[model samples]
Each structure stands twice: as C-alpha cells, then as structure tokens.
Target: MRTALNLRLFLAAVIATAVALVATAVVLNFLFRLYFEDRLRDELETYLIQLSGNVAVTDSGEVEVGPLADPRFNNPLSGYYWQIEVAGADPVLSPSFWGAPMALERPEQPGVIRVQDINIGTEEPLAVAHWVILTGQDAAQRSLHLAVALDRTDLDVSVAGFRLNSTLWLAVLGAFLLIASAVQIRLGLRPLEKVRSEVNRVSRSPAGRLSDDYPTEVLPLVEEVNQLLDTNAATLERVRAGAGNLAHGLKTPLTILHGVERKLRKAGQDLLADELQTEIASIEHIVERELARHRDSGQSRQVCEVAPVVRRLSDALSQQPGSEQIRWSVEVDERLRAPFDEFDLTELVGNLLDNAMKWTDGRIVVRGALSGTVASLTVCDDGPGLSDAGHEIVLGRGRKADPERSGTGLGLSIADEMAQAHGCALTLDRSDMGGLSVMLAWEQAEAAPR
Candidate 1:
C-alpha cells in the first residue's frame, strides 16, 4: 500500500509532541517537588527559632519551655511538634508527640539550623529542623537543643495536587498542539496537491504546462516537471515524424512490389507472385499498426461527443458500395461523451463501422450512450457471428475470421489499441443482430454542454 504524506507527517508530529509533553510533565513534577520540600524546611526552621527563644535554664540546672503559639504542637499526634533539651536536665516536649520522643541529634554548630527526614511512628515521615543554643549567664549557661518537625504527608499532598493539575492542563495543551500540527501539515502539503492537479491538467490538455505560482521550496520541483513534460512532448513529436517519414519511404517500394507481383502473375508465375503478395501484405499491416500506435500515443486525453463521431462515420460508411442493401440503425444521445481525442475516436469508430459493413448480411446497428461517468459505443451487424473463442482471436494483429477476406487484418487491432491508449476497454461479443458486436467503453472526462 502507498503511504500518504499527510498521514505520515501527522503521525510523526503526534509522536514528537506526545514525547515532549510527557517529558515536560515529568521534569516539572520533579522540580516542583524539590521546591515544595525546600519551602517546607524553611517553615520548620522558623518554628525551631520560635521554640528556642521560648527555652530557658534554671539556676538549679533545670530546663523550662514556654507554650508555643501553634495549636498543632498541643494536639496529640498532630504530625507537628517542638522539643527543647538542656544538658543535665530533662527535655521539654510538645504534647503533640503523645509521649513518643523523637531521637533527633543536636546540630553541630549552635544557632545553625539543620534539617533531616525521620520516621515518627506513622505511615508518613517527618521533616525535622533542629538547632542548638546557649541558655543562661556564663557560669550557669547550658547547651539546649531545639527542634521543630512537620509531617512529610503535607508536602506529599501539595506536590500531588500540583502534579494532577499540571498534568490535566498539559494534556489539554498537547491536544491543541496536535490539532495545530495537523493543520500545519495539511497547509504545508497543499502545494504538492496543487502540483498533482496541474500535472493532471497537463495530461488532459494539448498544450498545457505547470504554473509558476508555487512556494520557493517547491519551485524547483515544478521547474523539473515542466522540463520533463517538454522533453516528453519533443520526444513524441520526433517519434511521430520518424514513423511518418518511414511510412512514406516504404510506400513507394510496396507499390513497386505490387506492380512486380502483377507482372509475375501475367507471366504465369502464380506461386512466386502469391508469396510476394503475402509478404507485402504483412509489411503493410505492420506499418499501419505501428502508425496507429504512434498517433494514439501522441494524442492528449479529451472529452469528445460520441454521437457526432458515430453519426459521421455511419453516414460515410452507409454510402459505401456494399452498405446500400444494409439497414443502418444509430441509437446515440447527443450529450454522450467519452475521454478520447476526436481524431482517435474517429479512427476507432471508423474501423468498427468499416468492419461491420464488410460482414453484415443486411442490417447494422451503432449505439452510443452515457451512464453516469461512463460512455459506451457499440457496433453490431447481422451476419455469421463468431464463437466466443473467435472474438479473442480476431482482436490479435493479422488475425481474421476468414483468411480469404481482402483486408490487412489490422482494423480490430488498431481499434483495440486506441481504446487501451485512452484507458478504455474494448470487447467483442455475440451481437443481438446475429453477428459480432464490438463495444468500446471509457470513463468520461467531463460532462458535455447540453
């Protein structure tokens, strides 16, 4: 199967955009988590400073702490706590711990806060910020350790919320990007589509060429295509000219051979003359077939009314010597058209009519009709019809139903070649008139004017 450029480009864009958005979401979530954790540690440090300021050492080496302002420190297992420790004295703890003391170590430097994560007998961990300070006068001074801790679950909840919201918004953004990418791809490929249309126009036109109204990126392609078309037209012209010249060159010799054959027959050399005549007829058939092929190849596709061509050929053929006794019938609509050059259509119809005139006992029929976009032309006669096998045999070059018939045996072959050249189908079948029926059908290029 052929891959479409639009589909391939859209798929690539979809993959790239999806990958980029996922990476963005991951990175943003990671960075946000770190920032949220940092902010949480700063808040814990602030609480630690408040707790240290509330601590004091007694003259008898006893530790004392004032009630902290935050209510979470007073509630049992509230995931928030404060503790104060003095050397040679019992530590003062926040009621929020519920008698579960945290094994926090003292900070190395006094008055410097240090933060760490520790499990607090709960499903989530705690973020602890601790500091050491000196309390009391010089002789009575005591090193006191102050600490404030908050549950890690709070940070987890905040980060989780941010991640959810960010993902939702980012997904929406990715959707927009995908739609925009699809539109961009379609717009970007429009010029190529136009080029294809112009090429089709050229094929259907006699002297058509591609236009210069294209993007700079596609201009070179357009120029190359135009050059190729010019080269092809030139090549076909040369081929037709050569074929015509060769035909003219051989005509005189064939004519001379005919004269020689007649003289040999008059001299009673019947066998030798007959062989020469056969050779000459074979050469003539080859020349005629090649000429017809060359002519059909050079012609451009066109929409020509089928009725007029059939009528004209029928009128001319009906006036021939043998067609006088035959009853002619033409059933064709005036609007019926086929995708074929007028010259080629004339030659094709002429061959069928001429062949019918040769074999018809008394009646011949020609039909032309348009059904939807397809147009058909059929010529039938009332004569001895061939069997199904003979239908295929007569379509071959130099093949005829009767060898004794005075013809080059190329009429049906040439007609079939013309039909195929225009992408048409030509078939032979048993006619209702008791003879061969040759039908040519092709898709019409455009509707003919009423």
Candidate 2:
C-alpha cells in the first residue's frame, strides 16, 4: 500500500512525456498533410498555366491544344491529365484522360484559376485546377475552359509515409526522455538516502550526528534532525539521573529495615521478623527490576562480539562456590555480533548463567552463532527443566518454579525484560543436556571491525 517517491515521480514523468509526444505527432501529421496537398495543388496549377499558353482557336471555330512536354500526360490513366474546352466546339483532351472528362466546376470569371478535388472514375480522387480564359476579339471572341488534374492517392501515400517515420522517431524520443527522467529522479533523491543512513548511524552510536555537507534543499531537514537528536540525548541523561536518585533514596530505608528485622529476631519475635523479611525482600526485588529496566531503556544499541561476553561470564561464574564442580562448555563464534548494549548483554547473559549454575546438574552449555542477519545465543544446562506451563510462570517477577530455592526469583524475569528491550526474543525450551535452555535471538547489526 505504500508508494515510493521515485516510482511516483517516474510515473508522472512518463505520462507527461507520452502526452506531449502524442500531441506533437498529431500536429505534425496534420501540418504535413496540408503541406503535401498544397504542393500537389501548385503542381496542378503549373500544368493549367502550360495548357493555357498552348491553347488556340482556328477561324473555322475548332479548338486546338499544342503538345506539352510531360510524359505522364501521354500515358492513359496515369493519374495526370489536361483538358481544354472552347465554346461550341469539341474539348481537347490529354492521352492520359482516355477521353473521359473530369467533372470540374469552372472558374466563374475569365483569367481566374480555381483548384478543388474531383472524382473521374478512378480509385482515388483528383486535385484539379481549372481556369476560364477569353480568346479572340470582337464577334470572334470566345471563352476557353482550361483544366489540369493529378491523382490524390499520390499525395495520400506521401503523407502516410511521413506519419510512419514521424511516429517512429517520436517513440524513440519518448524512450530517451523516460530514461532521463528516471536518472533525474534518482539523483534528485540521493540526499534523502544519505539522511537515512546518517539517522541509522546516530541510532547505533551514542555520539553520531548528521553532517551539514548536503544540498541547499535538504540542509534544513538535516539541521532539524540533528537538533532533535540533541534534545533526546539531553532528555535521556536527565531520566537516567532521576532513576539513580530514586534508587539511592529507596535503598537507605531498605537497609535500615534489614537492621530492624535483625533486632526483632534477637528479641524472639520470629513471626513479625519473618513478615518484615518477606516485605523487605519483595521491595528489594522490585527496586532491582525497575533499576535494570531503566538502565536498559537508556542504553544505546551497538554491535558487540558475542563470544567474549559469553566466555567472560562463564569464567566469572566458574569461580563461584557451586560452579567449581560444574563443567562450562562455551561454543561461540568470535565474529558473531548483534545489536546490543554491552551492559545489557552482560546483565542478560549473567542472569541466565547464574540461574543455570543454581539448578544445573554439573554441566552447562553456552553457544552463540550467526544465521544470516540474525544472531542467536543459547544457554543450556543439565538441571531439571520447567514444564511447558511453568516456562511462562517463571518469567514473571518473584515467581520461581521451585519455591524452596534459596534466592528471589527475579533472575529470569530481568533477563527476559532486557532481551525484550533489545528487540530480542527469549525462549525457554528443553535442552539436549536434560535441563532448561534459554535462547536469545536478535537481528545482527552491520559488520564492523572489532
């Protein structure tokens, strides 16, 4: 449903060019027909002048026509003919006429020549020039009608050939115009393409900004976009500062409550102390989850190698108390890179590995690979995995599959939130290692030197 600007412009240019060429062809055809017909009429008039000069009247009153030089006039039905008529005498005809006179309307006045189209029993019409002349003096004076004609089919054939040639050339011109229009549209829109690339660069890096080296027409848009990026960057800094202040303000009270819970336990008030502990833990989980979300929200997306982060997390976790007895299998390509903030990737992978270290049965597998533009990171363990329904429940805050586990159930929830923030999908499935498999996949960014 979305139309491209280049396509729209090209289509408009095509329609306009087609219309102009068609109109030109029509006008040219009409003008050429008139021109060719005018030339034919002039030729006929020339013949009529020659015939007038050669005409004579004898004393006995018989009309005589001297021989003319044109050979076409001597051939019968040759589409050329001449005729001379004297009052009260038989008409003088050319050999081409075959004794058939053209039905021509004579000029009303002597010495006046008129030209018109007339049919003379031929397939095509004839262009005839007729002249009425007075010969002799006094009582011997007589009116002479002189006429000459040529077949209209000759003129029609010439015009038709002109039309064909003109149309072919016009079509060639139209094609050239269309190609030129397409190139113009592409060159004209190149600035917008540059703007899009610059915008993408800004999104992928915290400090990237649009440059001013652009055309005059596109400069204003570039300036506005750079200003907007500056504004958003300022706003994000303020939001991060606010989140930090909120965390500090809330943490102090939670710390004091922890001390108070210890006092109540020393006084043997076990029930009240337990209740306070539960509330304190709940508040702590909420604070941590919210703080993580805030951090992820302000993080700029960039490409980072997946193997280094995975291996670093694995090494750090391996030194932990329980993980010392477990085997960590890391199989990630060094070149596999995805659009993710380093801190976000660390937090997400760290949580998944920590969770696996908790329930994993002495063996864990971490794998990262790139498939086309998508990069996938999978962390699997030999620990007992969750059922299909429990998969969804564990992703909720504070909801652990086994309530008896000695930790707050915020790990998977925070990892899931971070994955979603980075436009990645976190899925839980049964691992081949007989435990939970947490896979995070996202579209990879353009390749960059590490």
Pick by TM-score: which candidate is best?
Answer: 1
User: Candidate 1 lDDT (Cα, whole model)?
Assistant: 0.84
Model 2 C-alpha lDDT per residue in residues 122-172, reported as the tens digit of each score: 445888889899989999898999988888887888889999999999999
Q: Which ten residues in a row have the lowest lDDT in candidate 1?
A: 296-305
What lDDT tens digits, residue by residue, belong to model 1 across residues 23-128? 9999999999989887997789788888877777777777777887898888988988888777665677888877567788777788788899988655558898
Off by over 4 Å in 2: 69-71, 87-90, 211-213, 259-302, 315-328, 357-365, 371-374, 381-390, 401-407, 429-436, 443-450
Report the error of model 1 at residue 257, Å: 1.2
RMSD of each: 3.1, 3.6
List the pairs of residues colliding in candidate 2.
none
Model 2: lowest-lDDT 10 consecutive positions:
296-305
The TM-score between candidate 2 and the true structure equals 0.84
Candidate 1 — which pairs collide?
none
Local distance difference test scores for all models: 0.84, 0.85
TM-score of 1: 0.87
